[model samples]
Target: MKLLFKSTLVLFTTALLSQAFAKTTICYKKDWNSPATIEVEKLEGGECKGELSYRDMLKNGWFLKDIKIEKGKDGLNYIYTLTDKRVVEIDNATILKNEYKKLDYRPFAIKILNVTDETATINVGNLRVGQSGIVQHYYEDNKTLIVSNAYVTSSNETASTLKFFPFTDLKQNAIPTSNRKPVTGDVIIMNYMYDSSLIIAPSQDAFSATREKYKDNNFLHSDLFAAKLKSEGIPTPPKEVIQEYAISQNLGTIFFIIDNTIYVVDSKTFAILDKDIISYNYIENKRMPFYTRVEKIEKNIFTSMLDYKSWFGFLNKIFGDDTRSEDERLLENEIAAGELTVKGEVYNNYYETMLGIKK
Candidate 1:
């Protein structure tokens, strides 16, 4: 009799708790492009009388997309639809009307659909041929850490593919073994430039296409840097431990080539500064070693951060003698010396992020 009473008491408590934590079945989509899925969301405390709010969804990085009511045997079923975000697609007419200029240079949030040994396919619909970014994974605590660098070699209207590379030291001849690889559902911050002096490609074949043009360039090659790291002792460091070390040697500007296009991205703001498409043709109606015509069409995107003078200096350094005016050199020195007043908030934010100085 005593054993029976004890068992009954335990069962009663468990039932009461279950009733108190009862949830409403809700409909949700992981992203806008995803299919609707069903989930049971916990109701608030206090006799289980509280209702779900939009604030609760926002707290979990979700937004209310729609709500529906359907008649059921239990009386009425309430289906609440939610999505990660509301994405408004850019129409072709708007793009043709120069309305793309109104869009801000915000980091694109993309989800990994599939993964492989060296690459991952993403759900991002519009990625330029040479665009790059960083892949990250969120922990249970909601904090996200960088996993690898991602580069786009090809993209279309619905899906895009990315190649992954490990984070490496800019000045060292060593590549630390990456402890993590991108898996499905990992988030990618697309077009987020990690450093200014870095030039990245998805593979050796992609890099070889533009190798002849940049033979005299002083840019850091991601593949060569990774090779150097392999030659050194393979040291696998934690993600947080490698954050500062990965960025300490950055000089500030990113250049990447995909096929015939070269893209320039500003490391400070992670914004694309320019795109140049190289066209080749035979001169004098005949193919000759000395008569091959290589022409370039430059898209001059003038911004306050990257003025024509800065662009000229960048070109000169890569193609010319790397000479800088005294004023420019002094400004750079001031920036390196932590004089925030010299370059304003843009440079200050850049330095803060570059040095991993959290606010």
Candidate 2:
């Protein structure tokens, strides 16, 4: 009995020590510059599964390159690894700070249409010619809407006003109805005015000049705009040409021009989330049932049309008639589909059916 008690006590103490000495492996990588070194420290009260703190790296101008946590083979340890080493630490905060000084003389404002318990409806105000507006901030803390001042302008209208009303009076009281939906955090809005009378031509120099002025603001002046132009199949401009034209303006909205039609981008990541293209065939004075068309031009890839209709009345109301073609009846049956195939592998039907791709 005495020997058995001693053995039990030793086992209990061993288990306690093992629990207290848990550790984990943390992996990290440096930026494009090879041989990048980083000093890491164990934070007090941190995870028993080894966790590395980069507080020192952040202070030394080193940002997070990439970090991912995974379960270890034994299931007791958590492995953290940095995947990408190309991400460089940029001084975005410094750039934004410097851009504030060169802000044009424009009083930034938003017309509060309504304020509710969970949301606020507001319209962006326009700036006068030669004046600019800035998006200082958009935040909600303790149920209060806070906006900042930022400005941009061109020689267009001398003045404009934004309307505001009580929240209870606006339509769709359940949901906020501003010009655009605000993300949960803050939705900063900036307005700019351009003189329509000015016959301005597109030029690289003009855009460059504007970019220089707002260098600190990180405004997507020309480089970003140029990419947008190409993605939409718009004609690309010369490399370094300047044009005398009114600066295009946005009312705190994403702007895109497709086939001479302008569009607004509203999401934080302004990438085309989803797109469907439809083609119509003019039949013998009468429309026929929409059929799915599939085409495989390369590899295990295929493209197809999934649906069509004579009139997309619902879409016309929101996107407006601009999306409509010249035909008297809107073609609602055209859609483009993409599919991929792998050699010696079964094709994944999941991708096609999930996005309504007929092929």
Per-residue lDDT for 1-359 in model 2, tens only? 33543453354345334433232222332121211222343322212122444444343333332232222232211112211221211222222222122223122345433333223333432332112222223435544432322222212233333221121111121221222222323433433331111111122232233334333333433433433333432221211111111123232222222212122221221211122122222222211110112221121112112111211333354346775434423232121121211211111121112112313
Number of the top candidate by lDDT? 1
Pairs of residues at least 3 apart in sequence or in different chains that clash in candidate 1: 174-229, 175-229, 196-252, 196-253
Residue 256, model 1: Cα distance from true site in angstroms = 12
- Report every candidate's CA lDDT: 0.42, 0.26
Task: Mark the regions of model 2 whose C-alpha exceeds 4 Å error after superposition.
Answer: 1-141, 144-161, 164-201, 213-217, 236-359
> Candidate 1: misplaced stretches above 4 Å?
1-104, 169-178, 194-273, 276-359
Give the Å error, residue 310, model 2: 24
Worst 10 residues of 1 by lDDT: 284-293
lDDT (C-alpha) at residue 6 in model 2 = 40
Identify the leading candidate in terms of TM-score.
1
Q: For every model shown, what is its TM-score relative to the native structure?
A: 0.30, 0.20
After TM-score superposition, what is the CA distance of residue 320 in candidate 1 from its true location, in Å?
A: 18
